[model samples]
Target: MRLEEIARRLGLEAAVAGKGMAAEVTGGYCSDLLSDVMANAKEGYVWVTIQTHQNVVAVAGLTSVAGVVIAGGHRPDEETIARAGHEGVTILLTPMSGFEVAGRVHALLSQTS
Candidate 1:
């Protein structure tokens, strides 16, 4: 599934940073720890978290995630938004919990895989 489709299917509010929703959503990773995401998230994986700091963007960029899903209706700060836009990181927003978001994304990906 593509990022656009995922957003639509899940009714997520997309707050794309740099690049548009062109990423191919491959896998799912749910974690609130920055280090865990950086270590475990793979390229094309949509990272699900509630962290709204600029460091999230740094980790997303470092790990090469397809996008970052800010669950539980959490919003990123302006600085983080600016940094993500500068770094071309995609950010998707949803009111669902991280576990729910991850499971839904996993289900969608499973269909494709």
Candidate 2:
């Protein structure tokens, strides 16, 4: 699945146009803790979390995540958006909870698999 497709399926709002939209979504990971994501999130995964801090962008770039879906209507701060754009990371916002986003992502990946 592609990042765009996943974003569409989850009704996400893209923060940066076309950024990481073409990246392949190999899987998804949901976690609010940066350390847990850094330790376990697989490359090419779309991360679902409520974290909107600037450092999340750095972690996404380092982990090579396909994109980030900020759940529960959370939007990244100005610095976070700038960092994400600079790092070529996709940031998506969703009104749904993290669990809801995770379930949708899991279903989408499972269908493609």
Candidate 3:
């Protein structure tokens, strides 16, 4: 599924609105630890986390994630938003918890598969 579709299906709002909306979302990974995500998140996976920092955009770029979903109604700071936009990493916002977002993403991916 595409990042835009995931946003639509999950009722997510764009925080940075990067240019990766057309990117394919192969999977989803939920984590707060940056190191864990860097090591484990697959390419094209929409990452679900509460860490709303510029470093999150850097890590997402390194891992080539489809996007970063800020769960629990969190919003990225200005620096994070700038970095995400510069790096072309889509940042999505949601009011749901990370677990809820993960479940929905998994269900959608499963349906597509």
Candidate 4:
């Protein structure tokens, strides 16, 4: 599934979508720990996290994930948003919890698979 489709289907707000809207959603990763995501998140995966720090953008860039979903209605800081835009990292926001986001993402990917 495409990032655009996933965002639309999930009703995720494109908080900082400078680019990468067409990125593929190969899978999903849910974690609030940056190191865990850096170690395990794969390319094109949708990361579900509550972290709103700028380092989230850095890790997203490093992991090459399709997008980072700030769950539980948490919004990234201004600096983080700017960093995400500058890095072309698609930052999605949602009121759902990380568990809900992960389940929805899994269901979406499973359907496509």
Per-residue CA lDDT of model 1 for 1-113, tens digit only, reads 88888988999987874463778877878899998888899998889999999999999988888889999999999988888888889898999998898888888888888
Candidates 1 and 4 compared by TM-score, better number = 4
Clashing pairs in 3: none
Q: Lowest-scoring 10 consecutive residues by lDDT in candidate 3? A: 15-24
| Ordered list by lDDT, greatest first | 4, 3, 2, 1
Write model 3 residue lDDT over 7-106, tens digit each, in one string: 9988999987776788988888889999999999998889999998789998999999889999999888999998888888899999999999999999
Per TM-score, the best of the predicted structures is 4
Candidate 2 off by > 4 Å: none
Q: Measured by C-alpha RMSD in angstroms, how accurate is candidate 3?
A: 0.9
TM-score of each: 0.93, 0.94, 0.95, 0.96
Q: Tens digit of lDDT per residue, candidate 2, span 1-113?
A: 99998888767899964356898889888899999999988889989999999989988988988888899998789999998888788899989999988898998889989
What's the best-to-worst order under TM-score?
A: 4, 3, 2, 1
- For model 1, the stretches where C-alpha displacement exceeds 4 angstroms are none
Name the better of 1 and 4 by lDDT.
Answer: 4
Of models 2 and 4, which has the larger lDDT? 4
What lDDT is reached at residue 39 by model 4?
A: 95
> Model 2 TM-score?
0.94
